[model samples]
Every structure is written in C-alpha cells, then in structure tokens.
Target chain A: MQEVVNFIDLNLIMVGYLFIVGFTGGLVSGFIGSGGAFVLTPGMMSLGVPGTVAVASNMCHKFPKALVGAIKRYKYGQVDIKLGLVMAASASLGVQIGIKIQQIILEKWGQAGSNLYVSLSFVLILVTVGGYVFYDARKSARRTDTAGEMVSNLARRLQRIQLPPMIHFKTADVRISLWLTLPVGFATGMLAATIAVGGFIGVPGMIYVLGASSLIASATELVIAFVMGLGGSINWALHGMVDIRLTLIILAGSLLGVQLGAIGTTYVKEHMIKIVMGTIMLIVAFSRGFAIPQYLAQLKLIEVEENTIRILSAVSFGIMCLALAVGAVIILAAMWKGRFAAEEGAELPDKGSSLEVVSQES
Target chain B: MSGRSYARRKRPYGKVIGFGMLTAALYAAVYLNAPVVMTYFTKGGVYAVLPIATVFLFSYVHGTFAGSLWSLLGIDAKRTRLQERMEKRPAATRKISRPRPRLHA
Candidate 1:
C-alpha cells in the first residue's frame, strides 16, 4: 500500500478561498443540478492540498451538498426520484468501469498520460455537448412563448421504440425504453470517474435523450450525483484519503449555496438552465484545453520550458475559476431578473379586467 | 417590506437560529479538535465511517439552517397559482396491460 500524503495547514486566507469557491460552486450546482465540484478538486490542489485528498474531500462535500440541493428542488416539484435512482443504478456500475479504465491508463501511461487523456476527453465532450446546448438555448430564447420544454425529435423517436421494459417517468412526462437509459447513465458515470462531473452528461442526456425537461433533468441530476458521490467517497475514505477539515469547510458554504441555487431555479425559465449549463461547460472546456499543453509537455510529447508549463497551469486553474464564476454570475443575474419580473407582475393591475372595463365603457 | 408585514409572512426564525447554532457548534468542535479528528478519521478501516457520518450530520443540520435562512430572507420558490394547480394534479400511475393467450391462432 502507498503511504498517505500529509494534509495541508489551513491559514485564514486558505479557509476563505475554500468557503467562497464552495459557495459559488454550491450556487451553480443547485441552480444547474450538476455539482460545482469539478473546480473544487483543482481549487483545493492549488492551495497545496494533495490531489487525492482534494478529490476525496470534494467527493465527501459533494454528496451532502447534493442531498441538500435535491431535497430543496424536490419541494419545488421539479425532481424525478425514480428516474434519478434508475440512472444512478446504472451510473454506479459505470463508475466502476470508469475506475478500471483510469487504473489501466495510469498503469500504461503513468500520471502525465492519464491526465492528458482526461483533459482531451474534457475538451472534446464539453465543447461538443456545450455548444449544442447553448445553441438550443439561444434558439429557445428567440421564441416568444417558451412555457415548457419541447421534447427533442431524437427523444420522441426513442420513445416510440417498445423494447420490453418501458419505464414511465411522470414528472419528465415521458415513457422510454429502460435499455436507452443505460448508455446515458454509463457515460455519465464514466465521465464522472474521468473528469469528476458526470452531471454534464447526465443532465443533458436526461433532457435530450430521455425527454425530461431541463428542470427535471437538472434536479434529478442531484440524485445521481448524491448516489455516485456517496459511493465514491466511501471508496476514497476507505483508502484514508478524505480530509475532514476540508470537507466540512466546503460543506459549510455549499449547503447555503445549494439551497439558494435551488430557489433560483423555481423563479427562472427552463432555457436558463441550459444556458447556464452550456456556458459553464463551454468555459470549462477552455479551462481544460489550457491544461492539455502542459500535460503534453509532462509526457515529453512536446518540448516546453518548466516556467512556461507553470504559467500555463496557473492560467488553466484561473480559467477554471472563471468558468465557475461566470456560471454563478449568470445564475444570479437570471434570478434577480426573474424576481423583479415576478414582483412587477404582482403590482400591475390585471390586463383582462382593464380590457373588460374599457369594453363596458364603450 | 415593513417589519410588521415581514412578521406576517411567518418565516421560521426559530429553526434558522437553532440549526445555525448547532451547525456552528459542530464546526467549532471539528476544527478545534482538528488534530484528533484527522488522526482517527484517516485510520482507514471502520474509522472510515467517521468522515461519512460527520458529513451526513453536518448536511442535515447545516442544510436545514441554510434552507431556513433563505426562507427568512424571503428568497423562496415562485408560488404562481398555475404552478400550484399543476402540482395539485395527481401523479399519473402506469397501467401495464398484459396480452391474453389465444386458444387458437
């Protein structure tokens, strides 16, 4: 067995950094239904915490934050618990396979090569999916009366397939083959193991493939994240990798953020979820893109100076933070606008009543 | 909103304060005894449950506090009559129909 790494000493500045990131991460996660944890691992690592410990601590914080967020959204009548559980059931298996793949990569190419593979996967997946989601959101935004999510043509087609074991998801209002959910769940779990953000795939899959609304898809993602995070955290804890102090501090901020994020969801339009998720995914793709060059250098596939690699690493981490910050800003702005609109609607006299009075006067 | 009007809204201050205090106390205990907590938590066997248990405890306590704080601030889910109506609509139950066996085909 490998020797465990020592935990980093927490100064006031470090504590503050963790709390702020945790809050924003929680906020984004709550609003989008996928966690803000992708950044936390790197965020903790940047503060001199070991990578394993950072990941373990991040996982430890994730399940609890997700549990909180899921419950809040459930109250809003957005969550589909049955769908989440079904997806999670397959997703847990995907995580195991994903871990096996990672282990194989680590053994074959060592750490640098494994990192390059993860980064490349992040860049490819985030760009393709994020681009599509953002484009769809933009199209939806142009419509005057976008009250509910339109089921994707692909999902509708999939729903017609009557393979034995058709499951009905009531909140999502779709009945699709159980076989169809496996690939999505598996991919979500695999990605989660690889890049630590399965919700990227899970939420989008639920929305587009399974024909769930963005609201339900995102909310249900909390369930998948909670289940997966708990399973992963237990595994890491068994290895003595979780740093309780780090977990607790992050949890402190995330709990509040998650609830606030969940509240923001009820106030906003459905496309806004796609917009936030898409935008973050795109930005995070860039962040991961920046890291690829350094990993290439580490693997000696490209000749680069140590100083340049350091600078690139810093830029990558900065971009990652920017991705999270951008998501948080968009969510906050959308929430504020939604709240203002709601209040104004409340204050204004009924247009129907006014029209009736004018007709009577005439 | 006026304080009196705000009071009429009926925010759960008691739950907020109670959970907040408990969360704070729990945090203080963990941090103040950081060395001991770290040592036992990382023992890598049955001790693994400590971190899991601790986080679950915090989530329940602090999670409630956060939820209450938001409610107290009047930051809440949109309560449109339409949404209420939609929610009140009973959940659809799936009716699976089995094919009857034919005596002769």
Candidate 2:
C-alpha cells in the first residue's frame, strides 16, 4: 500500500461545512439508526477529501455515534442486544467476502470499473429496497388504525417454517429460526462493504423478514452498525487510511446531533422511522443515479461531454445533501409536534370541568 | 405551581459543564499535537490501536456531554402510557427443548 496521504488543508469555510453536514448526518442516523454515511462520504468528497479518507474517517466516527444511539434506545427498551450480536456475527463474515470481491474487481478493471460497480450496486439496491419501503410506509400511513401493531406478511410466513434452533428476540417480540436471521445479517454486511451503507438492508430485513417492528429494527440496526463500524475502522486504520482530524471534527457536531435525534425517535410513532429511511434512500438513489453517467464516461463506456458530466456530479452531490437536510427537518418537526401535543394534553382539563373544578379534583 | 414544578425538574448543569470542558481539552490536545499524533497513528501496525482508542474515549466524553446538554435544554423523551405498560409487562417465557424419542432396545 502506498503511504501517500492526500490530507486536505482545512480552512474556516471547510470546517463550518463539515460541522453542519456532520450534525445533519448524525441527526438522521440517530433517528433512523443506519444512515448518515450516505451523506457524509459524499459531503467530504465534495470538500476535496479523498474517497478513502472520507470513508475511513466516517467509519471511525460511526461506531461511537452508533454506540451512543444504541445505548439511548436500549434505555427506551427498543434494542435487542442478543439479536443484534447474532446478526453482527454473520454480517462481519459477509463484509470480508464483500471486500474480497471489491479487491478482485479493482485489480481486474481498475478504478473506473470499481467506481462503476459501486455506483450500479447503490442504484440497484437503493431503488428496489427504498421503493418497497416507501410503499410500505405509505400503506401503513393510509391505515385507519394508526396505533395498531405492524405485521409483515413475509415475516409471518418465515416464522411458520419452524426450522430447528429457533431464536426468540424479547425486545422485538419476535421468534424465528436462527437460519432465517443469518441471511439478513449477511446481506447487511455485504451491502455495507459494497456501498458503505449497511443499515439500508439491516433495518428493512429485520422488519420485513425477522418480524421485528420498525422501531426495534431501526434501533437494533445501530448495534449492528456499532460492531461493523468498529471492525471496519480498525481495518482501515491498519491500512493508514483514517484521518483522525476529520473524524474528531465530525464527531464534535455529530455527538450532539445524534443525541437529539435519539430523543426525537422517542417522541414520534414507529412509521416515522420508515418514512425518513425510505425518503433518504430514494433521494440518495437518485443522487447515485446521477453520478453513474460520470463514472461511465470515465470508463469510456459512453461518450458524454465533460461539462455535462461535471454538472451531473455536482447535482448528484447537491441532491445527497438535500436528502440529509430533508430527513433532519422531518425528524425535528415530528419531535416538536409530538412534544407540544404531550405538553398540551398534560395541561388540558377534562371536558366537563372548569379550572376550579379541575383544581378541586386534583 | 407550574413554576415550582418546572424548577423541580433539575437540569444536569454540572455534568454538562464537566464533560464539556473535558471534551474541549481533549480536542485541544489533539489539535496542538496533530503532526506527531497523526504520524504515529498512521504507522500501520499496532499503531492502529491509537485511532480506535481515541474515538472510544471521545465517544464516552462527548457523548455524555451531548446527552446532558439536551436534558438541560428540556429536549427529552416523553414517558408515554404505552411505554410504561410495556415496561410493566412480565418477561416472555422461552421455549424449552422437547425430549427426543429413545431408540428401540
């Protein structure tokens, strides 16, 4: 490995940009459990940080943020540690395989090919999964019984198989075969390795296949993220790819944002997480979709004007930033509304009671 | 009565300030000694421990500060009736293993 590090000179404007981006990304991660990387990586790259450094620094920051988020959710009785650990065990193995595949592709077809491969995978997975999640959230929203328990048809079917060595998740209120759980963890790891976004698959898989509710799935995904991020960070650090400066600066803002985001989750309903996750996914898919033409041009697979490619790249990054911003707004707004309503309910008197009657009753 | 109740909800000012100061000092140290720290941390070997350990330390310190900061600002999770109900429920029983049939003598 070449030891040449392309560390960017940090100016005031760059610092400010990174801090804001970090806070927004952290907020989203805190709320939904496993995003923020999809934004932070591109955000750093836009500021002239190399792709490897951005990824490594993001991974370095991720474990800590996930740790804090997981702990907070656990306090809320939203995390299933046993299930998270089981899934993480398989996910780590999947990450190793995913990395090996990427290395081979890099060796065979060079940088452009690797970039094209990553971009295509991002577009494909994000579209299919994001589209389904969005549709599910919409359907759930349309239901008259908003407070009713969510049941996944696929999860129900999976649970009926009665495969040997069934595991029960208490926090999630789920019982399913151990073998059935492995694929979700494995796919989460593979996707994390491929596009550096594991939660996209992990959260949905837990909800749809393992019969975990969206709330538990999102919270549990943070545990998987913590484990995966720690391992990935160590691997990247060993390769001398991590920029500690970037990691710390981002952490400074993200720490606060993540706490607020976690608190926000407590205020909102379960479906809100799905809505945020799906919205971010669809927007980011479009962002990556835009960047594909540029990668194709690099590989000489298609002829496109340089200016057009440049514009597309810029628009793609902007859209990515927009996704993070939109997610942050939704989380904060929901939290505020929920808090306000709770406060009002606490203060309001009963319909038949005046202030004097309420006071006497109290 | 409302004022009294509000006042009774004590803010974690001490924790916020203490952790905030400690976090600031750590950041200052890293920034002041950036060259030496960066060089040693990126040496690619047992040096890998440096970055990992540093992040964990920051998470503990800064994470606490952030949590306290929010509490002080009155941004907290509402204790809902549903959550209370869930908390009070008895733990679910785990399925026990059934005995296998014995082989014929």
- Among these predictions, the greatest DockQ belongs to 1
Docking class of 1: acceptable
The candidate 2 chain A region of ten consecutive residues with least summed lDDT is A349-358
TM-score of each: 0.91, 0.90
> What overall lDDT goes with each candidate model?
0.85, 0.84
**Native contacts retained by model 1, as a fraction?**
0.56
The C-alpha stretches of model 1 lying farther than 4 A from their native spots are A346-362, B1-8, B80-105
Encode model 1's per-residue lDDT on B2-105: one tens digit a residue.
Answer: 22433357889899999999998999999999999999998877889999999999999999999899889978776533244347877678666989878995
User: Per-residue lDDT tens digits of candidate 2, residues A1-362?
Assistant: 54798787778887788788888888998888877888888788878999889999999999999999988877776788999999999999999999999999999989888888999998999999999999988776665142333568999999998989998887677889999999999999999999988899999999899988777788889999999999889999998888899999999889888888888876775677888999999999989999898878888889999999999988988898898899999999988876775565554221211122112222
Residue B8 of model 1, lDDT score: 57
Write the residue-wise lDDT of candidate 1 on A155-243 in tens digits. 98999999979999766667999999999999999999899999999999998898887777999999999999999899889889999
Candidate 1, clashing residue pairs?
A: none
- How big an interface RMSD has model 1? 6.1
lDDT of 2 by residue, B1-105 (tens): 122343357899999999999999999999889888888887877889999999999999999999999989877765533255457768679677999889998
Candidate 2 differs from the real structure by a C-alpha RMSD in angstroms, to one decimal, of: 7.8
